[model samples]
Target: MIAALYWSMNIPGQVAMREGLEAQVKIINEQAQQTNARGIKLIPRIAGDGAEGIEKQIQQMYEMVALRPDAIVIQPTDNAALAKPLRAANRAKIPVIAYDQYIDDGELAAYISSDNFQAGVMGGEYVAAHFDNQKPIRLILVEYPHVSSTVERVNGFLDALSGNQQKYQILKTYEAVEPISGQRAGERILADFPQKDSVDVVFTVNDGGGLNVVEALAKAGRNEIFVATIDGDPKSVENIRKNRLTRIDSAQFCGPLGAEAIKAAYNVLRDQPTPRYALIPTFPITRETLSLYPGWAGPIPQDFKKPWSSLEPMWRGQSRVVIP
Candidate 1:
């Protein structure tokens, strides 16, 4: 069997996930060779950056469909933009597995990603714990509105904070999909707010932006604001350990996500039933728990338990909506 693994950008997180996928593919191939069974041929490609990158990803999807790979695993650059090509792959009878980002409209064999909503909830809970309901919190939110995962994270965070709505007020929201965009947005926020007293907390959807926000705060000599975010990048973890501006990070099990994506694609190719959606769980890593964190490129702490782990048996036979 053949598979095409399409990645969005060459960011740190994506790179780590790709490494995990590659490792799993190697193991699978080795086992197949030893057993004299068919092995999956994996073709990997990465998009450029920004708008141009998204276009390239769309083009690559169309090309992958033309190649007629047995299956295609994609981490979409833009959630909606790649729908047409994804549907084309479906029409071609090729199973498409979406990783990290969900395709809003498409016939996907499986959609694998971390429980983004829960990740946001973890961040929100961490922030909420820092202040009592009586204390007012001025919050600045930085988010990437393009991807469904980030959207879920934002919604989850807000949902967690809903109980304390009266205690916290969202001052503004900035759109930042990556580090550079995040830096720009952070600089703007700093320029506008200027004073440390203006903002009490900052919540970023991912560390890519969260780190930049911290930098912006530092540049303006305002590190007093507590920051919480998702994606426990190694730097973010270290920052949290050192008592830096970023206080908490909800870490995604990226390695497991990548391996699961490959496994789900293989199952579909083998004519086996695969879950429409498989959500990996995330854990919060704070300064106190920093030593235990396995870092961004993780082996995932064996002792760490996920709420959905016990429900997998039930999920296996659940009915799924097949996109036409």
Candidate 2:
């Protein structure tokens, strides 16, 4: 049996990521009942949310190493903290496949994740194009710095904005990735900027808590605020369609990512030459591009020969798989 270690399931994007992993197990279990082929069993472990959760995850990684599973698939919490266990796994000749997040130390058989940085660039491009004439665009960022994925996204967004020469000043930054903290951010934004047009844009790292911020602002009638967020949560995309505060949401191809991780592990076990790293493209859902997006559970839409923007946030007609 192989072991699968997942980060906090409380986050929507992580939940979507896990769906792909679970789907693999479901298919294998069903196939085992009908055929004579031996079934692959997966041992799943979950971490709690918050600071203590980080400790739990680290401890779990150490324990997983001791179990000596054939392979270990994980969405790591703190990259440096988990290195010891990962290195131990390496010594044991146990292959490790990571998704959603990556660890700096230890050898991973494969790493699969969304193009997080590109997703940020997509958000920045939309902001630059949407407010072309709006100079010195006042911005507020909602970010969580603990994870590499979110940090890469913010860096990509800033880089794109800089490339466009769109002059903008960051007004304030807030931290939150779930409901309670997001509500606090929403309330703080209201308090920080009471007047309309005081703030031009807010970019949230994901929809997990980002949605709550939208609701808080919407309820308070803060219609002028344009929000850009990552993660393809159905609610976030719907908000764009309804013309709400959320303007653009760059969504991850979560199901395929999860399935890919399992496939990568399988390939390693079979001694097949597997790519060390892979990234699934993200679909940026704006009001104009919403029609092209299939919900998280649906199939990935075919590439659009003519995309909505010249920047081209997604792969379009190319393979959904990208190695970068």
Q: Clashes per prediction?
A: 0, 1
Candidate 1 yields a Cα-based lDDT of: 0.78
TM-score computed on alpha carbons, candidate 2: 0.92
Worst 10 residues of 1 by lDDT: 309-318
- lDDT, each prediction: 0.78, 0.83
Error of 1 at 70 (Å): 0.6
Instruction: Compose the digit string of candidate 2's lDDT tens values, residues 1-324.
Output: 778898878877778778887897678667767886556688889986767777898888788888988899999887677788889999988999998888878898889888899889889888888786447889999998887788998998888788877888999999988777888999998999988889999999989879988998999898999899999888888899999999889888888778888878877776877778877777878888777888775577886642544455445523334543
Best candidate (score: TM-score): 2
Cα lDDT tens digits, model 1, 241-304, are: 8778888888887777788789888888777777788787776788656766776556666454
Residue 68 in candidate 2 has what lDDT?
88
Pairs of residues at least 3 apart in sequence or in different chains that clash in candidate 2: 303-316
Query: What residue pairs clash in candidate 1, if any at all?
Result: none
